[model samples]
Target: MKKILLTVFAITFFINAKAQSAEVAITKKENDTGKIYTSVEKAPQFPGGIQSFYHYLAATIVYPVDARTKNRQGRVIITMTIEKDGSLTDIKVVRGVSPSIDQEAVRAMSACPKWIPATQNGLPVRVLYTVPIAFTLGK
Candidate 1:
């Protein structure tokens, strides 16, 4: 009974911690030209959809030769602002594995076509978006 209670307490604590962190992130403010939102009524979408966006990434990302040779593999987290006009700006790597790999991920994202801008209260608004690109080596 004690073990079960301990497990339940741990789970509840973890969940509350996670929720708090997410709330903080969603409430973060940006000092850009216009107000940038982290949460929106309708999120921005790729031309076709999420699947098409993945297809675009797969076709555009070129694994850096140096990183591949050095056996560096990990996920790069990128953050960008999707503008009200459906353009992307302020592309940055929030988490990176290596310089070359990170740059490659940025390059691919930079070359992407415009996305459908996010909406809030029935009007288009700029929103902060994050994506993770993974680099892995095949056996």
Candidate 2:
């Protein structure tokens, strides 16, 4: 049927678009640095450390009203690259529960303070970090 064909086309288009975007990001990072690393010898960290990072998230995020009304609760896994300058870039939701929730996660990440840049061989390096933002309704 026409509807089925359209659906298939849409899915294919979306997949291709995502792949292209990812490729572009990878290419840009490689050009900026020699390589992108998932983990470095000294991984990036919030100024105050892990505990403070969690506290910052808890303080910063404002739950989306639509998601709260729908009772949608889950973790949104976000992937971002920490640049050698300690700033975050290329933030994207790797696993998203809902649009509103996902947007909120990205917003929080964008507002994050600079981290202590990751290091390899005692030199700063760009690192890819994945974090999960949990959305739970307060009963």
Candidate 3:
């Protein structure tokens, strides 16, 4: 009976440790002057929320003619810093399928309007945000 109890306690401790570790996996970065967080108390948002953001992307992203002709299709991953004033900067492609498509993705993201800006401890803060844009050719 004592052995069984010990084993159960050990299992519970490990389970709790695993859960805490998962929670700690959220990315956060800080600096002396300006801090950039990937996970914050409140995330930056588009003016009209996520659906509107997608709509904006759809309306803005024009498939590159060269890429379409070359049958280039894939998702382009982009990362940008959302400033305290909700402006986006440091826009770049983390992953790309082709040059034209990559450039188009950057163009679309760069043209987006200001976001709501992320918050930490109830004050506006800059955050690094990543977005993936997909380019698919119709069948």
Residue pairs in clash, model 1: none
Computed on alpha carbons, the lDDT of every model, listed in order, comes to 0.72, 0.72, 0.72
Question: What TM-score would every model get versus the actual structure?
Answer: 0.78, 0.78, 0.77
Per-residue lDDT tens digits for candidate 1, residues 74-139, read 778888988989999999999899999999989988898999988777788777888877676655
RMSD value for candidate 3: 15.0
Where is the poorest 10-residue window by lDDT in model 2?
A: 13-22
Q: What is the C-alpha lDDT profile of model 3 across 51-81, one tens digit per residue?
A: 6676676677777899978988877788898
The 10-residue segment with the lowest total lDDT in model 3: 13-22
Q: Note the residue pairs that clash in candidate 2.
A: none
Query: Which tens-of-lDDT digit does each residue in 1-139 have in candidate 2?
Result: 3333233223332211121222233423466565677655666888897666766777777888999799998778888988889999999999999999999999999999999987777888777788777777655
